[model samples]
Target: MNEDVSDGWAASAVAWIVEQGEDGDYGRRFVLDAPMRARIEGRGFRNALDVGCGEGRFCRIMQRAGIRTTGLDPTEALLARARELDPTGNYRLGRAETMELSAEFDLVVSYLSLIDVPDLGAAIARMVAALRPGGTLLIANLTSFSTAGQPDGWTRDGEGIPRFSIDHYMEERAIWVSWRGIRIQNWHRPLGTYMTLLLDHGLQLRLFVEPEPAGGDPERNAVHRRVPYFHIMEWQKPA
Candidate 1:
């Protein structure tokens, strides 16, 4: 993770935890959970590693599905909270770019965490290295469009419709995002950057989806449908 990003998260950890609660915020509850859980549960993975596991939410989910999961995060406070919440879980203090484990997991996940990483290539290389042969690397990330619209997210037009504007779509940089008392730095990179890096590492794409919100919040779902912000990708390491 970038120094600023790390610092930002460390400072915002408490607010983030409060905002996330036990079930997670609107996006995870409404948009990401079902699809991500379905993909993992159907795969029969023996063991998994969750990069940036934050409070061990997804780790608990995988554990419930009968997959041994290790949750890793660089933030000490969050890891402490995770351990406190799930005392039986394997939670580690670590950064994605420098994780030393290798060939140990059948499934590795980055659930909305890649945006916080500073060295995307190095982090991805470490993730691929950690996977055993035929293992899966699953990712849930903010769409490039969403990141590119940062700093100035949404605006109201003459007709009162929401308009999302994108500028510097191709530039890779970090911007601070604040919401609900949480402020953190997130990296912005073009979509192709992620695709090309994963492909270059010899991982084959298995699934790519832009899941629509299925939760009961009609107003929130409508906004998400108009401009989907998250995408999930599943990739496989060669056997």
Candidate 2:
């Protein structure tokens, strides 16, 4: 949500593209995309607005699946990469907090982008406004358990067995994420905060998925074996 966060993403732009291709990365391949596609595939949505769509990877996926999709992001570098990858893609310069559109899209997607948004309320409001009546707004985000937990990681026992910790579930906080040379900031909000944001706008929850690893290094994804790595929620605007 901090406009300053744009600098982090801009710096990590090329690294993200290299690390997170259409069907790569542990999280993207094992959890996010399939569920996002499943939620979108059978629906008769003619168009979608992918808010905070970094590099337009997911937007390209939806477009290839025959859904007209527009990728919106605040970072200039990432948007440039998106355009380069998909010359015909509708990649636009926009921030979640101030996004406006004339067309009411049938679907609006927030994929791992909400964590970066500083003005979450305004963003959600715009997401609701962008949806057509009875349309869908889907999100795949870091679960509260993950975000509210420590950023440097958990305390390990003498045996080096790591255990995750959550110190503040109710308070909003910003955490610095540095991994694999990709540095960024992610906002952590309570579970109720996100649910209430959408419900307050009259969007009804239809599906919730706490994804476990589809297939990956068992040891690396072991956290998912007992704890959820991310959540995919499907909410619908009343018809």
Candidate 3:
């Protein structure tokens, strides 16, 4: 893992905690949570490892759904908040690039965390290894199109409507972004890069989703109706 990325998260962890607390923002509360929970609630997963589990929000949710969850993150401040949220819960200080747990879990989730991780192949290899045979890996992330086409980079045409400006999207690039107080580095990797990394390990896609806003600020979520902002994918390890 890159030390810069780790340092960046250390700085941003507090603001991230605050954002997670305040209605989970548009993506978390309105779009990602429901569909993820739907797939998780009824499934019988004995144990789950939430990799890059900043603040342990998803771990707590999974615990409520009866899955024994372990939250793993590198940021100390975030882990501290995660511990505060669930005093008795398992929140470990580790990154996905190098994680070893007591045992493999039936479910492993990386929710919007991979963007910060520099080495997708290394990080995900560790993640896949942490899963038991036939286990599932669920990833919720910004699609390459969204990551490559940042609002700041968009150019307006004669009509003043923004048009996406993309260059070298296939090449991995570290892009920095901040909103409110959350400042961090997000990597932009093409779709094929992610697919090849997972498929090379023999994981098979079980479910894929691009969720829409449940119902809230129409203006804030209006773009998602036209283009998918986030994608959720479930991959199963060979049985």
Top lDDT model: 1
lDDT of 1 by residue, 1-239 (tens): 44434548888889989988889889999899999999998668999999999999999989989999999899988999999999988999999999999799999999999999889999999999999999999999999999999978889889997898889999999988898878898999999999999999999999999999986689889989988999999999999
Itemize residue pairs with steric clashes in candidate 1: none
lDDT of 3 at 213: 91
Task: Rank candidates by lDDT, best first.
Answer: 1, 3, 2
Model-by-model lDDT, in order? 0.93, 0.85, 0.85
- Scored by TM-score, the top model is 1
- Model 2 over residues 74-154: C-alpha lDDT tens digits? 888888888988998898898988988854799999999899988899999999999998899999999988888848556
**What ranking of all candidate models by TM-score puts the best one first?**
1, 2, 3
**For each candidate, C-alpha RMSD in Å?**
1.5, 1.8, 1.9
- What's the residue-level lDDT of 76 in candidate 1? 85
What C-alpha root-mean-square deviation, in Å, does candidate 2 show against the real structure? Answer: 1.8
lDDT of 3 by residue, 1-239 (tens): 54444447877877888888934767889899998898789889889999989888889889989999989988888889988878999889888888876447999999999987888999999998998999999999998888887636557889999666666778788888888897788899998999999999999999888999998789768767766779999999998
What's the distance in Å from true for residue 150, model 1?
0.6
